[model samples]
Target: MPEGLIVKALSGYYYVQNSEGGQPVQCRGRGIFKNRGESPLVGDRVLFSETENGEGTVEEILPRFSELIRPQIANADLAVLVFSVVRPELNLLLLDKFLVHTEHARMNALLVFTKMDRIPDDEEGESIRRVVEDARALYSSIGYEVILTSAHEGEGMDKLRQALAGHINMLAGQSGVGKSSLVNALVPGLTLATNEISTKLGRGKHTTRHVELIPLAGGGYMADTPGFSQLDFAELGIDEIGSCFREFRERASTCKFRGCTHTHEPHCAVLQAKEQGEISESRYSHYVGFMTEWKETKRRY
Candidate 1:
């Protein structure tokens, strides 16, 4: 069977990039996938056949090692969490929430802080600067790769490119945080739409409409999808959420009890670390918030 990767899907068409590397085949998925309630996604490895007509048809979707739900891609090697340090401003709580999902999914996360040139030098920018510095220290300490970049000024572009080299990277972040701009910078001549931030609304309109995996010059591929502001944790469980927080998971073994919720428990290693300033209170607070929300969800069930 001829094998290829579904690089882009649009309007019931799958553009499969074959290993032989000619033009991407505009293929339709086999009808059986619909009956099986499975759809071929960008980044999916597929077995396809050429029809009597010119186009091809996807016959089977091979098994995926990992799948991301938000933008919905299969076999993504890296999750590039892009965020702006200015404009819409940095949201640590949201970043931590994103980290939880990435951790749970077992996807290697690369934190790309964008728009560094937008950071102001005045007194008003003090807090923002502090937040960026702190976040770099905090997340880097937790074993994540952090790259600060300004796509406009070309700052850290080489570092960012080096980090993304030879891997299937999927970009995720809020709109206007420079996901498209970064992609444009990284991949020359490939212009991804980027909108100016609405000064009134403090957010950018969605510029990316669909998911399409673009092959990079550096022996890898990248998918830029619609940026989003919020995520649903409905797929996660209360107990499983603990292990998703890297710091909490690290201290889980030393807790007074197995499966410690880390909320008001005596001799809790996590709580103790939080009090001692080992764990960032900001991160711990969000973890507790997730726990509270999930608890309410469990009650309703």
Candidate 2:
């Protein structure tokens, strides 16, 4: 038996990349897997045996440290949450939602702001730049690696590569945020499909419809997943929601009551941090909003 990583899965076939460097072997899960209620996912490490036809059979799936349901990837080390500064405009709330999901999944996250060149070089652009910068600062303060990238101009490409070095990363964000462009820039000669934003709808068509792990030039793999338009915390509890916010979680220890939801609670350390500007007000607002949303969801159910 040989061990390899499953890089792609499509139509009952799994493409397993060899650890010793060769063409990815086409494989199919063993029938036992189906009987056992186990299916191989991309990013899974497995033990396989090659058959005479030059294909392989995935015998067993190794343990996975992390898994994402939407993209259906396993054992990812990082989630590169890509966003744009303009043209499909930046939605901080959506970005935060991605962060919340990433953190909840116990994966490291890198926030990449793409299409920096799209920001005009004028007074208006300056204002927009400031807003982006401030948001970057807020995320950075909470210990996230944030990079400003422009795939067309080659800005921050090196930094982005460095950040992705030696880790299985998934590029996730809204449609038209240039996730494909960024991946192309990071891995040369891989011209992944990219779409222009719709002027009327203010969103981009989904260019990446499926998830596949593309080997990165810098080392490790990047899973380009279909862009998402909406995300809801339907599976997370209200208390779990607050814990996803790093700053809030840290300050939550000081709250007067145990299990503080960090909303409308007197002597709440998280609220105090918001009042003192220790936490981003926008972030806190989102936290509170998610809390309310989760509560309502629980009530309705």
Q: lDDT of each model, Cα atoms only?
A: 0.90, 0.90
TM-score of each: 0.96, 0.97
Candidate 2 lands at a TM-score of 0.97
Candidate number with greatest TM-score: 2
Candidate 2 colliding pairs: none
Error of 1 at 67 (Å): 1.2
In model 2, state the lDDT of residue 141: 93
Clashes of 1: 0
User: For model 2, where is the 10-residue window of minimal lDDT?
Assistant: 286-295
For model 1, residues 204-293, the per-residue Cα lDDT tens digits are: 999999999988888889889888878767778977899998888989899998778899889999999999999988889999998887
